[model samples]
Target: RRYEQRIAAAARRAADRWAGYARTGDQIDLGAEMRHFALDTIWRALTGHPLDQATERELDRIATVVAALPQLPDGEQAGAAVAEDLARIDAVAHAAIAAARRHEDGPDGPGVLRVLLDAAELHPEYTERLIRDELVTLLVAGHETTATTLTWLYLLLDREPGARRWALDAGPEGSPERREAVQALVSETLRLYPSAWILPRHALTEDTLAGHRVEAGTDLLVCPYLTHRDPALWPDPERFDPARFGPGGSRPAHLGGYLPFGLGARACLGTQFALRESVAVLELLLPAFTVRFLDRPAGAVYSITVRPDGPTPVVLAAAV
Candidate 1:
């Protein structure tokens, strides 16, 4: 709730850029556009400023490193592969930290970076390096996940166009019913495409697992994708139905039934914020413009996060 104003501001900027597309008759890559909007939103929350293209271009190395992580050779080769990218990421992070230390406040206000800087004053433990790590983590976690989820939401709406009409028809703009419907759209998209498809966990002691045995200190992977799509847990699991997240909808009752943001304490802290940001953007865009897909992705690529395998070229037009 504290971040609502910044989220709305960010969404307005993105909506303006999108409106330009509708006005100019230019094609755009929807995936990239979503990424930009998300990056801008989180960047504002983190540093109280919009994401400039120059900084965003350098920070894009974060995605590059993430994608290359699974393919890198073992040991030192892995570090070598992403060394340049890491340096680039570090430069941006340190710059932000320095700015925060200087008490820089963006147009919105002082962001979380300012808070972290203040904490450092009272505690010696909050070192510069630690601050940098926190910023970068916020960037990767908040930016990539929300961006990808939104891209998937738009793609899903492209396929299930009726869902759009259903949502818009549910209630008037700015109404609670309309907001719920919009959130339902984001929820269903997340069910189909969780930010972190595979969450890594480890066993503290030996235990039985689904009628199988587990060894102490064993590494485990919890796959929310498979769990969310289990036909037993979700009837018609593969279907893109936003109503599933609506009131009286048949969402599973058990704790493990739905874990888009993971479960327990380790669950994403920004879950609510992400939903708010998504809804904010959708509220402004959904009723204003209709995206016409000029180039749809043929498949999905599952790396650090699952995303459209190819570019998503789209043209924006005034909603009829």
Candidate 2:
């Protein structure tokens, strides 16, 4: 409960930041702002403190490293290519861990880092290096996925303006109907452009999958983007229809047919958190302002995650 409260508070802060920018008529990079919002939310969860601008700037390297991952050579070559960015990320991680060790709590209070630190007292394996690794892992996984998802959602809304109206008209603000409608917007967006579009798995033993034989140690890539768009599973699969997720709307019943966050035990741990934060921000932004994209990306860049290939510059105005 306490953890959830902290997350909500952080999300509110991010939303407030956006609201301020909207009121001032500030031109904003929607994708960058979304990234900031996600990082701020997760940073608070990990450290019991809101993300500082300096730290946020340092962490920007995460995107660069993620973008470069696909093209980089394997093993030592890859590590060498990203060594500078890794150093910057490591410096930030070590500093945060050291600070958490020195201070029992941050401004908001003790956070997940404190919990890990507490465990270190009894578990010799939770070394400082391991703690840093965990912290960085959470930062990378938690922020990038949510940021990309939100960015894609906005881009989708820009293309399909009626979908925004559909959600706002579902019910009054804060109403269940409205929330569900907004969630459907996100769901449909995920259907089209799942952030972690591909899930890689290795077979441990000989097996059969969908009439195909797989040998032990075989590598497999499960692509949700492709599955979500399969016409056999989704009617008019290429269309952007949030109603597919609305009450009584038609959608495939098969679990494998639509998996934006993967499936089964290995599903994304931050699924609920991502949904909550995305919906919370939309609750405030969607009803209050209309975003006009100054320039839209030509296409997507598929790498560690599928993301807009270019900047998402936008201007905002108050909603009538």
lDDT values, one for every candidate:
0.89, 0.89
lDDT of 1 by residue, 1-320 (tens): 77888999889999999989999989998878998998889999999988888899998787778777566646796778589789989999998888877878888889999999989999999998898888898998998889889989999999999999988988998999999999999999999999788888899999999999999999999999999999999999999999998878889899898888999979998999999999999999999999999888898888768788988999999887
TM-score of each: 0.96, 0.94
Tens digit of per-residue lDDT, candidate 2, span 99-175: 89898467889888888899999999999889998999989999999999989999999989999999999999989
Best by TM-score: 1
Tell me, what's the RMSD of every candidate? 1.7, 2.0
Worst 10 residues of 1 by lDDT: 66-75
Off by over 4 Å in 1: 73-81
Count of residue pairs whose backbone atoms collide, per candidate: 0, 0
In TM-score terms, candidate 1 sits at 0.96
- Residue 35 alpha-carbon offset, candidate 1, angstroms: 0.8
